[model samples]
Target: MKKNLFRSSSLILLVILMNGCIRGYTPDVVLKKDGQPCISIPADEDFFRRQKEFNILGLDIFQTGVGELWSRHYLDSKDHYYVKNQQCLYFNYKFQTNILYDISFFSTEKGDEENRKSTKKVWMRYMRIIKKSDGTLQLLLDKEARDYY
Candidate 1:
């Protein structure tokens, strides 16, 4: 009995020690001077070209994976975040009565106007994702979105 108890406890302690030594996954997040978490990737291309196809991918990513990252950061669901790829991305995902994701991918706010452009790089000021009545997903950037999903 004594031998069994000692062996079991030793094994448990060794497992615990090994687990602690393993590191947790840390996302590649850059902190702004104002303490905002942002993804530092290049935003050189257009917001939603190719008939709003890019917006659809972004929306799908947010729903599945990006949203998980946002939750892990403990950010407010209602509050939007930013990504600095020189273009500026003030983004947010809202899952209220209607799922809404508005990512200001081309413009910056009043405070960080000098860091980037205050006005939109493209004609469409905002990149919004929407679902069509046909049960298919689509992106609504502006008047042009009416033609696409």
Candidate 2:
């Protein structure tokens, strides 16, 4: 009887540990320079595979000059933006009585020779992601231009 009880306890412990491993991992939300909550999503294989689709979606939603620039720039220099300490992309989403979603990408590098006074180069683009009634995510570029420093 004691042996059976010990086996049962061990089985239960194993199940609990396995459950944690099986669960999908979500990164923690962090604050941007502007104080908005952002959840970083790594630019892994999955993201690159869908890059074209995302750019088309952004262009279709934004339909503005700056939006066009963002779509082109993102695809061209995406690799340059990848940094170990920085997030490749981030989303800000909240669900309550109403739903709100936004996505942004930011990059900073050493300043160009022309801008010798400043030691860093920075740029950021923001867009809104809305959930359609059919449950699809739609993108919308913010009216504000990209912030550069």
Question: Considering every candidate listed, which one attains the maximal lDDT?
Answer: 2
At residue 84, give the lDDT of candidate 2.
30
lDDT of 1: 0.31
Candidate 2 residue spans exceeding 4 A from truth: 1-87, 90-107, 110-119, 144-149
Per-residue error (Å), model 2, residue 107: 4.7
Best by TM-score: 2
**Model 1 poorest 10 in a row by lDDT:** 52-61
What stretches of model 1 exceed 4 Å from their correct place?
1-42, 45-82, 86-90, 95-124, 146-149
Residue 104 in model 1: lDDT: 20
TM of each candidate vs. truth:
0.23, 0.25
Cα lDDT tens digits for candidate 1, 1-149: 56655654564354346334322211122334443334323343326432211111121112211232222221233443444344223334332212332222222322343333222221112223445687544444334433333
Residue 50, candidate 2: alpha-carbon lDDT: 49
Per-residue lDDT tens digits for candidate 2, residues 82-124, read 3332242433223221122223232222222243222221222
* Angstrom error at residue 47, model 2: 22
Error of 1 at 93 (Å): 3.8
Q: Whole-model Cα lDDT per candidate?
A: 0.31, 0.32
Model 2 vs. true fold: TM: 0.25
